[model samples]
Target chain A: MYTDLVAALDIGGTKIAGALVDGHGRILVRAQRPTPARENGDTVMRAVEEVLAELTASPLWGRASGVGIGSAGPVDASAGTVSPVNVPGWRDFPLVARVRAAAGNLPVELIGDGVAITAAEHWQGAARGHDNALCMVVSTGVGGGLVLGGRLHPGPTGNAGHIGHISVDLDGDLCPCGSHGCVERIASGPNIARRALENGWRPGADGDTSAAAVAAAARAGDPVAVASFERAAQALAAGIAATATLVEIDIAVIGGGVGKAGDVLFEPLRKALSTYATLSFVRHLTVAPAQMGTDAGLVGAAAAALAKRTDAAAAGV
Target chain B: MYTDLVAALDIGGTKIAGALVDGHGRILVRAQRPTPARENGDTVMRAVEEVLAELTASPLWGRASGVGIGSAGPVDASAGTVSPVNVPGWRDFPLVARVRAAAGNLPVELIGDGVAITAAEHWQGAARGHDNALCMVVSTGVGGGLVLGGRLHPGPTGNAGHIGHISVDLDGDLCPCGSHGCVERIASGPNIARRALENGWRPGADGDTSAAAVAAAARAGDPVAVASFERAAQALAAGIAATATLVEIDIAVIGGGVGKAGDVLFEPLRKALSTYATLSFVRHLTVAPAQMGTDAGLVGAAAAALAKRTDAAAAGV
Candidate 1:
């Protein structure tokens, strides 16, 4: 089979997206459907099927050698299943098997959304050419993935870089994930907004209280808002430093809404990094903004699919 | 060149040890010397050379294919240099090149001591069958290494899993490494003893004030000593759990003096782990004592040499 393309799927709580991507990561056809997140598992699965149906109907589908899925985790690549926390209807859902069946028995590769984004970054964005890196998303929730020895390290369960859940403050606040002082609890967008509000940073006339609003306020010299962002930066710096110390990543690529805060996040992050990344090997680590846009998930899925196809070909599968 | 043995050197501040190791990880011949740690760099080099010379004089030296050194870090495997903190006399020393020349131009492999111990454990001890694990030493200072995908992850500079310096409490005590609230600052043997003494725990009739003595006091139900051990356990648990959460390790193998505290350490460690390792993938992580003893560094150095030799052979080098 001289297949030159792969089908990619990016499944999240809000949407099910599908695409036929070439070796160069160019999408030739696309499909998407709103996720019935609160509906039954079957309905959510049906939305995914509808998106896959559209992709299968495209002429580009003929060149797709395999199917790649980057889904909201926790995903079990070993079991080919996913049970994303936001999508309660899909507990231990057998996604890979269903996608494989829907794609005419094509081989399937699955990874967490964070891992998928890392794949995209490593393949074509900020992490490109870096042998070891950490790529993170700090929007509604903090999530991340890693590249080790120049390859994506999805780990045994496809969730290697769960930095958000790692405790940076052992005795701080409890996270919904059942851990205390998690990075997400301190650095995520919602948490940033919450902290700013708790510190008496009232919203503007429009009453916009998102982290973006906080960033604007910080830009306008609001001390309380600035302090909130600073705290979030400290937590993120601690987490990033911890990751580098553990695995020797030379760069951390930050993405998502909160990452878009620009200097409000990066300046404080760099300063705080010096406080935590003190080891000789880790002291030289750098942080950067992510380059890939919303299409990161699809492109990253394609990268993984291509890698899987190459591996299978090497094994003569 | 059908070599069946490799020469191994385990270099630290206190001692320099060498061995001729077989393919099965057995030490067939050995040599040792005290490190003149405070002397000039040449003196330290001389001690290492003496140990290597003894190994080279052994009858089994004829079968040695390469030389491997597991040295107190920070080691730069890429630069073939080392600058161990306790051995200040040898900064950026070209130990690998010297060892290679000393070993009759044989290939040389170098790794950090923590990584070396991890290799030993993964090859023959606590982490033997696990594909992913973290092996730690909580002695005078904390140190650790990782086994990922069933291989020792020595990382680019040969220092990957340096979990001791990771901050589990972002706003707590300042660490000598310049980081705040590092695991070593809270959980190391010296730190444990320091905390116990600072909290008003009196020394015994022998006036011993080591972490081992604190462990004994805790074992005998001394409240202050117990509290100190519990605190150390909490820090270790947070560090270990963070490692597991980030890298998906199924087990954490702890060694060194504090690890010998048995229930005094492991009991509270397991309890605190439940508080931090709350992610679905990390919830099942286990903790165990290292099976490899003082010779772990030697055996692990041998393991790296064997791996290097195998890679060379496979590449037709």
Candidate 2:
């Protein structure tokens, strides 16, 4: 049984989330602070320290062993540096070392938030008990992590489960990754909205409507809305089926805000799988909505620290 | 340095290969014997014992510490039982315990041949140094092993790299595994030859024809032969490109007798990849021929044993 507490941190585009979690994967104390955007590494480090200090000051932080930080894209966990594409300020940031510096000299574990989300699913959510599966979040931007063969697959660059970048439409739109027809470009929220807007489906006749609103309209008999979401769902499912085929993943966990579309998204996606499900081994592959909701990153960060503590105890290191 | 040696065995439909390999991943002696048709598990075990004894009697077998066997499909590695579909008379055969008994108490390891081949590729083949790739042998039946994110992936049933079974066409063809549109069912060796034979094409006008003969005929201006091979190539390429998109594999190595179609296959396969690569990730993927040739299986068997022995040694068991 787990007997120690861990420091879990989530680094986002504009904020940092920190929490002290018990061995049973429970959050004891939590703190959140804005990231020092456009600032140098020292400023960002100070922000993270402040966030961790806030949690450490809590009486619940007693006996905590180490820290785990989850950051955004293009991260390198092997080197414990974050190279988030959206936050250029974090290019090659020595995140683990920085967290360790303020963590009373305990070990620091850094991983991609997507990877953390996947691990969280493995440790506490939909992907539990399945050695090979994917946790895909289709929100502001699509991000995912892979749990393959009972182990997390954080690539040499810590970008193993970058499914959004997978191509589903060769002649589709261009993606931010400089690729044409990426799943993200053709299926993410922005793409969905862009397609809807272009096809004359106005959100409040052009308001701040999200993909959820579009899904609602689709269900309410809006043809353009249905068309856009269906198209996105089709693209995502094709990519998912392809992943399932290649990795032999038994299940796919879809998270993020867009997943609330539920059947509106899943039905078309399943149909796409049916179209591509000729392979007996890969057919009838399951896709489900993620269970941990917005807290997946937090749960995953805790899991990473918990894993290190577990490993250390096992190794007697 | 290799302080221990393990006898490695590979059981395939066509051949049963055995090798005496040291712990350092080097093979000291290697030999092969054909697998008899409809040979039951008991008979195969007898052949296996003979092969092991021949190797153990050799000078290279002096240091072998254990035995490891990698066999064809539907095998239960955990229980050491084989239920290979291609090799009849093996109904839940206790292959592991049988091999262990034959080894006279040597530590035993059993896994899928795909896993072994992938392990071999990781240890010292085309996939070496590259963490995310797939090793495929497109012979009698298409089989594969996956190396994802710097580690080998063996699914819950130890069948993660069952790439050939992924459905490429829903209404395409029926596979032996009771699945329709499997990559293997559509594009594998027998299927390729069957397509050629069923197409009513003369193999270069009165030749004792096979797939290779048909390829020759196609090269020599047989319209039907060219179309048959092209269709097979296209299906295989679609499967390959789809895999690349999902797994982000940098390279895929094609082996087996069918791969002997050479440019006749690769050229059209690459063209299909170019045409059907929905994502840039897939489009840029590399497909190559396996470098280790027939030695791959034997080497993979060695690699599997190496992992087992090394893990045991590290565990201080």
Candidate 3:
């Protein structure tokens, strides 16, 4: 099984990425296309088709045994459909069927992008050796997935580890997801920037008001910037602690733009964790930066495909 | 294995209960003793031994094939130890080893009391037939267990579903467990009574200030009493919602004293669930009163023993 290759797609609101990946997790062929996200579902499917066409043009395409998709979600893995919050036009899109058809009717595996990243981390990155882990993307919108008891826990809907939307503060700020005090509302990249600006932190002459700007200011000893990151860290700590308590995860891997803030985020995050992760079994949990880079989604999709194929073969399918 | 009986024990800070349970989960024989919790660990073990001695003396004892124990936790099944918070006399006590020795070297299984209840719920109670569920006991202190993918998720240390201590309000009041705004601190029976009293709700001439008294007051239209239950309901809803969001549980079964508050708790809890459980997959989650009664711990311990023996036999161990 490890000698075979899989065709993988990482579909997001911004782009469609496809790769032919060997079982070793190395991409042997790659292609990309801008997503027509605002267009109708068919148009968005066309862009994905174009990416698949490019991948199929490669000589390595013939060697691929299955197709795997990691898509921005509300994915219904049971129904083989997706409705990404960021891709309104693709609501309830029949993604698995489309990908399977485009990939020469090969067996297809579909999972939410968060779960995909978790698969990648568990297979070859930060969570590689851990039997239970949480891998998160603390970006414009916080998202995450779980690896429980050494398997990808995508759940029935491929959306089990949607940590970003879980309320850490029952009485805190309202989130766009219609919940109040969600982890993403406090800890995402935009939230970090918003809190900093709300607290009277100003950007430099560059006029960049992103979380990165706040990170730079915090590094230069700006009190307001530091406080904002600490607040975000606090919310993240509580959410992570709650997750660990519920599921017994041993490690939390943080990625995305905000996570890359380095000490500005990690230092405060480590400090706040001690306050919330108080249980005897959970007290030993550690947080680390995610080692998977931008290609994580594609690699993770490939991993899921390989896993499915292996399971199918074992079942004598 | 359904033709064989098993020995089951439920050990708490207050009592040691033992039973010779048949394969059908019926308690054919029972024994119990008050726990000398304030005494040394050896003294506490004596009470357990006495209970076991009574069980061993039963006419049906020879039919028991295995033993299972559910103890007040922080229990480490991997290390065969327990250090229950309320039982200060036994920290890291070798409970499994002690039980194994006392049970004539028969195969033994151990799990946290919460997990035991969950096993009961999953096996034959409200969560029956559900592939994923959270079963909770909302009594003097909130405790819970999980059944994921059709099996009891006791986790590596037999303490997976210790939901009572997970903080829902990260910045709220400090919990005795060293965290803040834990579900237990807000929604447990004692907390309900304490909060009702703190908010100027008084007891009647009989001087009963228990949560059951508060429940009676709420039923009789006492606004302060109603509000106290509402607050507890809100915290419970948040915690349940968080659990559903993280693990994709389809239902949450509530048992124990506060759960017996009936509509006074359930009505508000059902209403509050919608406010926090707004995610796509989790929005459909339901809450119900647990069907298993006072003997859930014993029945669940028996279930665990049966399951262990079955698995061991399958593995040819």
lDDT of 2 by residue, B159-272 (tens): 567777765554446677655567788778778878888978755446657777877877787788778878878777766765664556778888788777888888888877
Question: What TM-score should be assigned to candidate 2?
Answer: 0.76
For model 3, the stretches where C-alpha displacement exceeds 4 angstroms are: A1-3, B1-3
Poorest 10 consecutive residues by lDDT, candidate 2 chain B: B275-284
Q: Write the per-residue lDDT of candidate 1 for residues B140-235, one digit (tens) a residue.
A: 989999999988899999999999999999999999999999999999999999999999999989999999999999999999999999999999
Residue runs of model 2 more than 4 Å from their true location after superposition: A35-46, A56-62, A102-105, A149-151, A168-173, A194-209, A221-234, A270-285, B1-5, B19-66, B74-108, B126-133, B138-142, B147-151, B163-289
CA shift at A22, candidate 2, in angstroms? 2.5
Docking class of 3: high
The better candidate by DockQ, 2 or 3, is: 3
Candidate 1: DockQ? 0.90
The candidates score, on chain A by TM-score, as follows 0.98, 0.94, 0.98
> How accurate locally is residue B205 in candidate 3, as Cα lDDT from 0 to 100?
100
Lowest lDDT 10-residue stretch of candidate 3 chain B: B1-10
Rank all candidate structures by their DockQ, best first, as comma-separated numbers.
1, 3, 2
lDDT for position A299 in model 1: 93
- List the pairs of residues colliding in candidate 1: none
